[model samples]
Structures are given as structure tokens and as C-alpha cells.
Target: MSGSPPAGSQQQGAVPNPGSPGPSSPTAGNSGSSVLVHVAGAVVHPGVVELPSGSRVYQAIAAAGGELPEAAADAVNLAAVLQDGEQLFIRTKDQAAAVPGPGAQSGAAGAAGPPPGGAVIGPTAGTIVDLNTAGLAELMTLPRVGPVLAQRILDFRRQHGTFATAQELDAVDGIGPKLLASLLPLLRV
Candidate 1:
């Protein structure tokens, strides 16, 4: 009885049934509604950062690397309020894309097969990666795709539209039977 809470107090050692939903369960600002935010990129730490309401973009910048020398001064509204899930992009001065050169239309490498020794087919069946959402870096990972061909793939997708079928990649200048064969399994709409 000594371990029990006194009258009018909550019972000692009683576990609150957290699974039960009450009116407060689903309401914002309730005990279950607390959420912390993370900020990265061009900032001081470039890692997890917790912020409360009224935190500003400058705060995240300070948490990262205090901003790179080439980070656009005008890119971020230093005083702007940071949203809970916002990710800020600060471009660097040297991170510019150069114009394409000759062989920009060089054909795709034909029929990329499994690693070790190349073949027309892969050891395990291929899986598709979406071109629409994939970045230039990702497309470059494909076999025989030099930087130029990767850019062309992005440009073609942007000019036309998302690729529904993997076969549609044949539309890109460099993509041929060889390239398509390798890319087929790795593509998704």
C-alpha cells in the first residue's frame, strides 16, 4: 500500500493504454503530435537538425558548413521562416554544367550482360529504374553511358515525357539493342 499513490492522485505503476484513441489522440498538438524536423544541404552540419516553430532558414544554414563560398547569397531568404519538412538547396559557384561536345550522339553500347564476363543477359533478371524521377548521376550508372549520353537521356525525357515502357528508351539517340538489352531490366516507368 505504501507504493500506491495517495487518494486523488494517479495510481502508481499503472500503465497508460497508449493504443487507445481518444479525442486528443488524433488532434494536432496532442501528446502524440510532436514531430521534430531535420535540415541539410549547404548548412553547417548537413545532418539531423531539430527545430521548433519560428526557426528560420538561416538557422539551418548555420547548422551546416556555415555556407560554402560559392553558395548564392540571394538563393535563400535568410530571414524566411523554415517549414517543418523544407529542404533548402544552395547552389555552388563551380557546380555548373558545360555544353556538350562531339559524339553527343554516339550510339549506346549493345546488349550489356552480367558483370565478370559480359553477355546479352544478366545473371539475375533486371529491375527497372524510373527515368522520369532518376537523376543524371543515376542514369550514368548504366553500362557504356558516358556523361554525354546520360545528359541526353535526361534531356529527351524532359522534352518528350516520362517513359511508360522500357522499350521507349530506344527513342534516345544512343540507346540501341545492346544498350536497351542491358537497360531493360533496370528501367521502371
Candidate 2:
């Protein structure tokens, strides 16, 4: 027993905590919280991936089976943090060039679709957001809507039931004329 370690204790830092998630675990970070991101475009696999919360864009790309040879990987800010229900689209080199960068001209709201080359990263940018069924994450995708407003909308729906008309959203607390008008085109009852 001279050279043996204590029976109840192991070498310091040598034994991992059994209760903790290992590096290989899907929930290694963010305390077991995870987010689903839809990675589309030039990746080898285009689909949704479940990543630990606070995962970066590059992780999403890797989760989608890595970028294709033709993917304009440089166009993506790989260090950007991923959000739940987010869509991370990788465009081809040619497509990347076609899509304007920040400060570029965007058509009137809801008048035109997202720019070519998958420049838009929102999950509901050009898609219809069903007010009655939309969740907090989906509602947050709308312009000018944040966690508080999104929750308010949900509370309103639960209290008053399904929205009969798109305009009905204005009745929700904090949803003023300007906000309602801005969200009208992107919302559907």
C-alpha cells in the first residue's frame, strides 16, 4: 500500500466527474441546453442540426456535414453565435458575389424576397409566420420583435385564442401601430 493512492480518492485532475458531461457529449456546454439551426445551401448536408446553446456558426456548418467545395465559406462569419430556430445558409462563390453585403439596398419590406445567394440568415425572413401557431423563437425572427414582445404575443393568443385576423395582433400589449404595420406582411392568421 506504500505506492498505492487512497482508496476513496483518485489523482487530482486525473478522474473526470461522473456527473459532468464529457467533451464528446452533445451538451458539453451551456449546461445541457441546446439549439436547433437549419443549415442550408452549399453544405454537403442541408438540414437542421442540434447544437449546444451558444454554438458558433462554424459548428453549424460542420454539423451540416461541412461546406461543399463550391461553398463560399469565407462569406460566413463563422464566429457568429447561433440562435435557436436560426437558419444558416452557405452560398456558392458566385452567389455570394451576387448578394449585397451590409448597408446594401434592400427592397421595401415584404415587397421582395430575401436577397439571392442566401445572404439572409433569418428562419422566417421571407416566410410566412403563422401568428396563431408561431412560437416565441419564430416570433422573435420578425423585425422589431424581441423576447418580451414575442412572449406578449403568445400570452395574447393564449388568452384570446387564435388570431382571427393579422390586424388583431395590434391588440397585444406593446404592439403599436408601427410595429403591427411592420409585422403585417410577415404574419398570417
User: All models: lDDT?
Assistant: 0.44, 0.59
On a 0 to 100 scale, what is the lDDT of residue 47 in model 1? Answer: 48
- For residues 78-180, what per-residue lDDT tens digits would candidate 1 score against the true structure? 5544544434444343321121122222334333311211111111123244566654434543455554676688789889988887799898987788778
Model 2 CA lDDT for position 115: 32
RMSD of each: 18.2, 12.4
Model 2 stretches astray by more than 4 angstroms: 1-30, 104-189
Clashes of each: 17, 0
Q: How far is 182's C-alpha from truth in model 2 (Å)?
A: 11
Model 2 whole-model lDDT (C-alpha atoms): 0.59
Q: In candidate 2, what are the lDDT values of residues 2-78, reduced to their tens digit?
A: 11122212121122233443333344344557776777777766777666777777666665656778877775556
Error of 1 at 130 (Å): 1.3
- Could you say which candidate leads in TM-score? 2
